[model samples]
Target: MGWSTKQIPSLRGRRALVTGANSGLGLQTALELARAGAHVTLACRDAGRADGAVATIRDQVPDADLEVRALDLASLASVRALAEALDGEGAPLDLLINNAGVMATPERRTADGFEQQLGTNHLGHFALTGLLLERLKAAPAPRVVTVSSGLHRIGRIDLDDLNWERRGYKRWGAYGQSKLANLLFARELQRRADAGDLALRSAAAHPGYSATHLQTAGPGQGGGVGDRLNALVGRVGNVLLATSDAYGAQPTLYAATHPEVSGGAYVGPTRLGQNRGPIGEVPSTRAGHDREVARRLWERSEQLTGVAFGLPAAEPVAG
Candidate 1:
């Protein structure tokens, strides 16, 4: 009756790249896109898992156009390599889904010495987007959909302690910061596109407590008690409040394919505190729409990730 994944328009000729597509929301998003006739690339850290996801999608759609590619979001080098590889292919990317992320976990640093959550959740995707900007622009109506979280409400971008070097890191706080950065990045990207007259559109979405392995795989993907607790709570909470991975993926799918979606718009569940429901437009936080903060975050992200997005000239608007 209402707009659902099945209602999404056909994407017959579109090519989509979805990060963390091996499981959970990412996998569901990728499969749905493929089912809608888009050729999907499953970008994941584990080649085996990516292969499995491709297999699963093929099993369902039978003729689904899918590919598995390795992408470790925690590593800048990996992001760069992936971008370069995609660019070398010279294929137009119609959709870019910044879906892979890490959740609350113990204090730790990535190979680049960034807080693990921030590194994988924000920086990795930041760099990847920058690298793929040209390919996105090559498309007729490209869209970049970044997945954020409700925890962003409590997040404050600590420029002085971005890496959690000066202050002690709290797992939830770090996760919140990363998720908040996601929203800011999407907004800033849209602003930049408008200013520079880029054809690509940027949008953000969040899964309302979808049951995923993020909690379990996140905390201990590096191995620790924090991982155990994260996984345990995620599993338990999933039973009580979390929705199915399919339902959880609705927001992202909507953001990616909805023709009415605008740049800088945020999408998520439309009911019950935004934790679970049908995918629809939702109000974004004031902070999420702060142009100044978005600009500053963009500059900081460029500096931190060393990936510059070269935007085109802006179209002048009549006053």
Candidate 2:
């Protein structure tokens, strides 16, 4: 439980749902979880990509119990549909991994007309988690592991412009905001669950400086000089500073299955600056645990996504 992937207990008989499991970190997370004996649902946007991911994992784990499903986090309709379908399966979902996200993309809106990063990264997963709460609660020691980022330290939440409608978008800034929301939601969920005495826990993790395709996944998807430049720079940085996606996944896996990790806890690389190393509980931004901000953000998310989590109101706490 201190800092090793080998510490992950057997996940047999567990059902895990991993969003954006088509490629990169999400795929790596799913592959490992499947190898660990959990039945994994690969919730991805593209069917072809999902199929490929499943094949790749099966090649390794041969009989890996896996299912491919469609999910586009940008659309609330898709989130609801996926949740409903999974709920209909009549099995407890032991783990909900909200790992899908876009990063450093050009300005664009989602199907819901919100900024792309915030829409997919925060709101989409927010709504999905809420919709699936029932299935999660049916399982023993059910957990929610939302992937956040170290960049959240520099992020600011402008609740008024959560989607940057009034203010113009800065891609990294917007990405930061969404990442901040990930941590806030994770911690707030844990707080609410504890207050209600529910047997559920939520935690967040970050794959610090992982060399995944994520850094370049979004920039050029919009087709612009700046977008291309961002992608190039990101790729360069990945080559120079990022760790392997396999290693990148340890913190996430640790948080998801490690028995010692408590609700509201954060797991990250244990080295200096928490950039890349062993997985362990690391210090996160104080703002991530800001009570007033978390409470307001939770309410606003409920209003925006229209997925009400019938938990008690969050109580204020000093940071």
Candidate 3:
């Protein structure tokens, strides 16, 4: 039988940090981990929303050990602050889930002046992982799970125009690029870990087409024509072809705790188009598997975010 959340072994004494835990897949993932006996930190931008999410989790799992911290993924300063706060706490992080992201939003600049989606989805998590690497490494069998998306297949990493400043941005394209970046970062981190002989394990997961606030939370949060259209599509998408948020979070939970998982593995739903079903290993895009591309993206990410990998460099290859 396939493993579900119930099958997950007790995570007592484990410490977990989940980004974007205020809603959607992040919130659900954090709650499930908490239920499994892990002390979870809900890293979110809004303190009020995070408190509410914690309350909801506590309502169901009265003993849920939860902490809410302010983290704006679109801002580098916020990322740094969050990292510093965690480091100051001096707690070992067993699992770090990079679950926060933006999808299909209008062109906007982040606090760091990068394109909004890329900034929040990729750079923010990139820096967070770097900043928290020490605590993660301190934990026994430390794992870093990054939540990507199926749209990664359609993504192309534009090295020159990473921020979409020169080229006009399309909502889906930007979102796809960020998701692809997530996978690439995971792969590259795995490579670095292996090359440096580090104990940390890095893997990636995709929720597939789960009914989440991602669509509406993007441009739709403001209430406009695009928002209305996105909301309509979201409703139709959920009805016609999408999984529940609970099901969507399966891959992430699996990636974080599955004993059989290895570094660089990608997990998602097992079903038509990977939209729904039990969590299982899935094939990644050729781009996602390209070691050279992964390395280059890693370097660029480090440079853009000003966060070093803190691991030995991988063997350079001809591009």
Candidate 4:
């Protein structure tokens, strides 16, 4: 049988941190993890929404061991602050789900001066993961699940114009690049863990087409007419064809909990185009498997975020 959330083993005593947990796939992922007996921290950018998410989960789980913390992925400072706070807790974090990200939006730079989509979706998680490596290492069989999207196949990582300084920033293309980076990071992290003989495992998952706030929030304000129209089309598509957030979250939950899932595994829905269905170990993109690109991206990410891999820096060619 295919993997399902119902098949998740007891996560008692495990500590998990899920970014973007205030809504959508992240919220559902956190809620299900809590139901499975894991203590989950919902790392979000807004406090009020986080609190609301907490209340929603408590209404169901009632005894859910949960915490809400501030995490603005667009700001490296905020990412570092979250890492520092977790370090202060001095507890092992068994799961680090880099589930926060932004979709298509108007051209904008992050607080750190990088393009918004790439900055929040990829760079921020890269830094946070590096900063929390030690805490994850302290746990038994630690796993990091990076959420990506199917649009990654069209992404081209313009090393020269990574921030879109030269390329005039096509919204969808930029979003694609960000999603591609997520997979590359997950793959490279797994290779690095193996090179260092660490017990930590890293994998990637895609939620498929799901209806969530990311659909509306991306084009609510500041985004141009093109983005707004895009959002309108997205809303219609989601209403007609997209799966629910709970169903969309299954791939991530499967990747996080399934023991049979190996490092560098790419999990997604097992239907047409891997859009929506039960979770399955899917094939990664050609770029996602490129060792050369992953290496350069890793180095560049370290320079951009100033957070190095916590393990003995081993440069391994990911196959």
Q: What TM-score against the true fold does each predicted structure earn?
A: 0.94, 0.97, 0.96, 0.96
> Against the true structure, whose TM-score is highest?
2
User: Tens-digit lDDT track for model 2 on 1-319?
Assistant: 3466566778899999999999888999999899889999999999999999999999999989999999999999999999999889878999999999998788899998889999999999999999999899899889999999999987899999999999977988999999999999999999999888889989999998998888888765677788788789889988998898888888889899888888898889988789866788888888987878988999999999999989997567656
Residue-level lDDT tens digits of model 4 in 9-69: 9999999999999999999999999999999999999999999999999999999999999
Clashing pairs in 1: 219-227, 220-223, 220-227
lDDT by residue (tens digit), candidate 3, 1-319: 7779988889999999999999889989999999999999999988999999999999999999999888999999999999998899899999999999988888899988999999999999999999999898889889999999999998889988999988988888999999999999998899899898988889999998888878566746546887788878877887777778888899999999999998998999877888766689999889888887778888899999999967976787666
Clashes of 4: 0
TM-score (C-alpha, index-matched) for candidate 1: 0.94
Which residue segments of model 1 deviate by more than 4 Å?
220-230, 312-319
Off by over 4 Å in 4: 310-319
Q: Write the per-residue lDDT of candidate 1 for residues 144-202, one digit (tens) a residue.
A: 99999988988888877888998877888898889989999998888888888888789
lDDT against the true structure, each candidate: 0.88, 0.90, 0.90, 0.91
What is the Å distance of residue 170 in model 3 from its true position?
Answer: 0.9
Candidate 1: deviation at residue 192, Å?
Answer: 0.3
